[model samples]
Target: MDIIDLGMGNPDGATPQPVVEAAIAAIQNPANHGYPPFMGTASFRHSITAWYQHRYGVALDPEGEALPLLGSKEGLTHLALAYVNPGDLVLVPSPAYPAHFRGPMIAGARIHNLILKPENDWLIDLAAIPDAVAEAAKILYFNYPSNPTAATAPRGVFPGDCRLCPQVRDSVGS
Candidate 1:
């Protein structure tokens, strides 16, 4: 019998040449023969810095903020471990990536789930968050380019407010 495999998240197009080339290079590199730095490398961090400064016009101190992860999922989990404390409140959006929920649990934080519905254009309602939850929340998980739903938010939805500080880390992702 002929068996076949199926998967999700595979690229619809052929793998790009540069990425293929990089993979070949990694296979041949003596330096990558073992486990690389658990925290990633300087060169990777520098590239992230360049990308942030050039594309986003956001300046980041590579040494301070550039974190190269195996993938965003693992990164967020470990990040929660680093930042969250026992009994601290975490705000998780409904219909979110499982890691967002699992991360908080791994870190021993209490979860305060808030529903994000389609009628709101998938934006978190500043109004919808309960006063008690908002007051107690120590982390907020936001995802855009949202999976399983294509909803996008105008930058206007974010007010650039600094006052939501004590409750959240002001982080967003996709």
Candidate 2:
């Protein structure tokens, strides 16, 4: 018998030498030893804001809008906690990363799984969702270069012509 493990998303390769070296140096710095700020150091947030501005031409306030998280899972969880309310509907892509669903679950939000079908290039078929569910949804979670499925949304499919129902207050994409 042969075994092939595919459930985990760990990288197949080692970290780049420069990146590892940089991490080691940062860890060794005396200035880096203290507990980090709750929302991350100002420098980290500023760097994130700057990257967004450079990559997407979007300006974000470092102090108010930008936050550095341990990882996307934690970020998504916090986002759910911040926006989701009990009885609120959360639209999530089916076959999504576990945290996408878990966050809303922890927030007591109703989970509305949007099926990502292969016929639609693994994108959610908005039309398939019931109008009531769509109208009640408060948050929509999407991930491009999606985990497990490895699906990529076409250009303009997100943050473009996509017209989520008016009730949607937050759309998180990673």
Candidate 3:
């Protein structure tokens, strides 16, 4: 019998040659053996800032704003710890990456799941959220190229379209 396995979302192929080579080179460097800086290296932060500026024509301060995390999971959790207060409401789309909800969970925030419908191209219906919930929500989480669903938000879905719901205080996009 043939069985299909689908739990982990790891890529099915080997790491690309360039990425593998870079990782190997980094590991071989004696300077990289020690524990990394808490906020990431200055060079990495600078690179990120430069990349953002180049890609989006937006300027970011490398020293103050560009933080490099080990991964999105750790970053999200830390963000939750920093921003969420106990009993605060967090709006998360359903069928989301586990970390999106887990971070808020660890922060003791109450999660209000917004169901992503196929009809809406997996986008949450912000209007469907009750006025009370929307008003009380501290954070609204969104993801493009969504895990599991692989849904991508249409252009102008954020900032432009999001302004329609003004009650939401903060939003985190992944």
TM-score of each: 0.73, 0.80, 0.80
Off by over 4 Å in 3: 1-8, 16-22, 158-174
Local distance difference test, each candidate: 0.75, 0.81, 0.81
What local lDDT does model 1 show for residue 37? 78
Report lDDT (Cα) of residue 14, candidate 3.
Answer: 91
Please, what are the lDDT tens digits per residue for candidate 3 over residues 1-174? Answer: 775433337676799999999999999999889997887889889999999988867699999998888788888888898999999999998888788889999999999999998999998787788888878988888878877588997655655345434433233231
The window of 10 residues in a row where model 2 has the poorest summed lDDT is 165-174
lDDT of 1 by residue, 23-137 (tens): 9998998977988676678888889999989886779988889877778788889978999999999988776777788999999999988677888987777766777787888
- Cα RMSD (angstroms) for every candidate in the order listed: 5.4, 4.0, 4.0
lDDT for model 2, on a 0 to 1 scale? 0.81
Of the two candidates 1 and 3, the one with more favorable TM-score, higher being better, is: 3
Candidate 2 deviant stretches above 4 angstroms: 1-8, 12-18, 158-161, 165-174
Model 3: per-residue Cα lDDT at residue 168: 30
